[model samples]
Target: MDVLSDVMTVLRTGRPFAARFAKSGPWSDHRIGRPNGFGVQLMVRGTAVAVTEGGETYKLGPGDALLVPHGAAHLVADSPDTPPGPRCEPGHAFPGAVLRSDDPEATHVILCLAYELAPNRNHPLIATLPDFVHIPADPGERPGLAGAIAMLDGELASEQRGGDTLVPALLDAVLMYLLRALLGPRTVECRFAGWATALADKAVGPALEAIHAAPARQWTVASLGEVAGLSRSAFAKRFTELVGQPPLAYLTSWRLTMAARLLADTEAPLASIARQVGYGSEFAFAAAFKRDFGTPPGQFRKQAPACDPGAEPFRREAVAV
Candidate 1:
């Protein structure tokens, strides 16, 4: 029932991101211009009736979810009786979806947030989804989702102490639930591996896990192949097929990602940081880091990449030995 928790899980596993919820007014019918970012809409309290291109109209209710693609224009209204007005183009992706209100009296609450997907790692599962995705309340299949939506509605209405924080988190959780519903059952290509058709293979899972677990682990094609339970050639072939990159290349990029995280979070000695990430010395780590990041770690950190606490990079996930 915690929407933010659910959304964060998807974000942690697939992308790094943040989310915030806001209140919107009941309008007759208003055209929403182009969106600059991607997001989902969760109708917590009041109905959000709308019509999109091709004159398609949707009646969103509580517990329903809509996905706006990178940038799409649409209309939203308090009721179908309202007429849609003009539209504007923001020149950026502002795609979105709809959420319905449960009670006519409850204030219309909309949850919106953006995520940063991995580089060259567009989640195929997400792409299969339509620009606008709607998740209707299913009592039998997804009671938790429904319950979470209701809880968010109540908390937002109450506006008690900590409501702002609690409400946004709940809304995030709902988005994650929706993502799982869309991705968990699907298998898709692994851009980091070329030998496999899908990244969801049990074998591929371990290899990916190991790479994410220790980016600087002196990984060799043979070693990664061992983890994947494939011969070197087979692993190379399959991994290249699934992930679309040589295993070593992916490992290097991950290492740089890890370094970026350390630079932003800790003021640890450069040598210590290098050793921690598997380099024998600071010089070696610096060389590799620069090769990958186009700048030395110290300089990059000085420039100060954005540090979002919620989207910390390369934090190791515990792996079963």
Candidate 2:
């Protein structure tokens, strides 16, 4: 897997819900924000407005999309001056909802999605992104984005074969498309210190690939610098500037993240998991794990239920379409 793929794999993803609806009258939705959630809004057929609590406003038109990576309190309405409307119900009320307005002369179709984003570690991928990311109406347009959203709609409307398995995968695909749109190739314009700049950078991208590819390897900054074809001092400076962490620091975090994922999903003993993630002894790994995750390896493993990727997705614990 590549760097983003590795991060996505390491992080734990929970149930995701989506709703598409059409409205024609004066309508607005107020959001208090989900500090632990990620949200997406797409203007499917007409116009809408998004405003942050800090008074920043963005006008979204057809084909435009916005991502609230760390759900911030905001308002989405037909116009900026529109008054706040009633708060929405929980995720259970979102799926397959076709809320319409009283009037039928005009129409504004929108797609709203919510995802439970829980990270096992301090992932920079989510940490360093801005408060909101808005992909222009036609900036690097992707035909597959709408298709992915439509697939989610189809699944929600009527569960298809492997719906449990397919829904989460579709959510991941839609999110990736949004992210890729945000981080266009080497010419990306976002002022991101994380994956956007790091992955596109020539010197740091290769080093990141090496660290993610072989976390078990005993890596030093010098070795990583050699891989980047730069001197140790030069590479360290550039890598820190772009990636928000030194090469060795990043390597350690990746190693621990892999260990946490292994504990969550596998039945391997501590010794085996430790060795696979570059720790020498079970005792040493336990100390490091406690320092980082605030819990011992045994307790963490016991508390975390296995979430196998290839297995069935989340059970509808009071969830309904």
Candidate 3:
């Protein structure tokens, strides 16, 4: 699997939630507090003003997107002076709530998304992201993000036959595009130096792919360096510089992350999971898991919520503004 896909597979928990809203006139501002997860706001039409927790304000126009990666409290309003109203409840649906204005031309449409990430297993890629990321709606600037927003807007606007199945997939695609837009070519030379840069490097990228592809392999610095077509010392230094950790350190973390997923999602035996994540024996794996997670694997499995096979893999709900 690709790096982003692999990271998301390990870090994402329950199904993501999303919604679209149609607002007209001068409405009371909405303050959203996501707590442990992240929230996304996209302006599909018209314009709005966004204020971060630190009082930073942004004017978001059509096609613009905002990501609250740290789950901070934020306000979205028709104008910067609009006072925030009551907190919106999760899963609340408002089809077409009338605001302060009845003018059809004053309507401001928005798409909102929420994601629940694994709190315990924070990946380097995610850790490297800032508290908030804003992507302006420039059609020719970042075509991927613009295209995703366009597709999502169309899908949400129309009542299609397979929309129930299609929208969730499209939301996931939009998320991928958003991340790509944030960590674009400009980030390679400055700012981001961890997983973002590592994934962009031709040499380090292949080595990371190899490790993620086969966590069970008995990998060494020399072996990984060979995969990157570099000498051991050079590869080690480069990997450390870009990935923000030694290769072995990252490998161990990845193995444990995979083990955590298997524990939560499957009934695989502890010994089996250990082997899958490259541990030689159950005892060793248990010790390592305890050290990393501060809980035994069995206990962790027992405490984790069971994955529902019959439920939708991705759930989305839209609220009217």
Candidate 4:
């Protein structure tokens, strides 16, 4: 998989999130889509039938996580053995409804929620993983996941906090935990290994940290090599092998990424934004921004929609650059 060069951080618009419970009696079928945005669904308890984007079907169980990456449509049901019957009418007080099941006597509750994922280009993790990520239960580490389920159950079962305020928060936390279990080790190692991660090399931590800490600073092969404690020539060779680009080239690209974020979010003056991002003047910043993004900063922001207040800007600095 090319050892993956980026990560994805979802941006939220400060919109309140919600979750609901569906009562299923023997026969129940439902469809889910990304009407609001991307989200993760944790099957806290019981087994459900899942049909993914490509029409592949699988039985999802407790502790399993369904990560809908690109807002593709999916179907989750109590049974795949039979077609669906009458759906519970809308405005039924809950997010889901009950249908007749094969058992005719067995009853189950399916928990669901709609959430927003922050957007960022620097991280490519979201596109790398499967549309649905299923996490297996760890008998020893059940407390955390189980507690998340409990919170969801309570939020849906009771009318506390004026609505289901806690379910989304709980689900988001649960997804983070699941991700930690799946990618935690790699992320930790990558941090110590440094920008070589982005460059696909090793022993580049100091350089990565320095670049991230001060994207606007003027940097060169000699200065970065000094930070890496290597001679300029040796550093240049090793850096190219890992980062896939010359030092000055990488620095320029990084600076442009920062400028993009500032333009997209803040209403800062052009000169000020340029200065903040290390450009010597407004003209220099605009030239670079135009070259990188295909338009000037002012024009880019004008064409773009108002960003989510809660969303972190699209700058590389906001992510692990």
TM-score for each candidate, following the candidate numbering: 0.64, 0.85, 0.88, 0.63
Clashes of 2: 0
Q: Local distance difference test, per candidate? A: 0.55, 0.74, 0.77, 0.54
The digit string of per-residue lDDT tens for model 1 on 1-321 reads 122231233222222222223334545433353333345556655677656665777787766777664434567666666666444222122212112223334355544434433222233233434556666656578777777766765654333566435544665566566655544432552222232233356666578777766665888999999999999999988777666668887666556665666676678888888877778889999999988768898997786444343342222111111
Better candidate number, 1 or 3, judged by lDDT: 3
Using lDDT as the measure, the top candidate is 3
Q: Rank the candidates by TM-score, best first.
A: 3, 2, 1, 4
Which residue segments of model 3 deviate by more than 4 Å? 89-106, 158-160, 185-191, 306-310, 313-321
- Candidate 4, backbone clash total: 12
Sorted by lDDT (best first), the order is 3, 2, 1, 4
What are the per-residue Cα lDDT tens digits for candidate 4 across 178-279? 555555434343322223243323344467667767777888889998988889998888776556667777677666765665666679899998888789
For every candidate, C-alpha RMSD to the true structure in Å: 9.2, 3.9, 3.8, 9.0
Cα lDDT for residue 120, model 2?
53
lDDT of 4: 0.54
By summed lDDT, which 10 consecutive residues of candidate 2 come out lowest?
95-104
- Residue 123 lDDT in candidate 4: 26
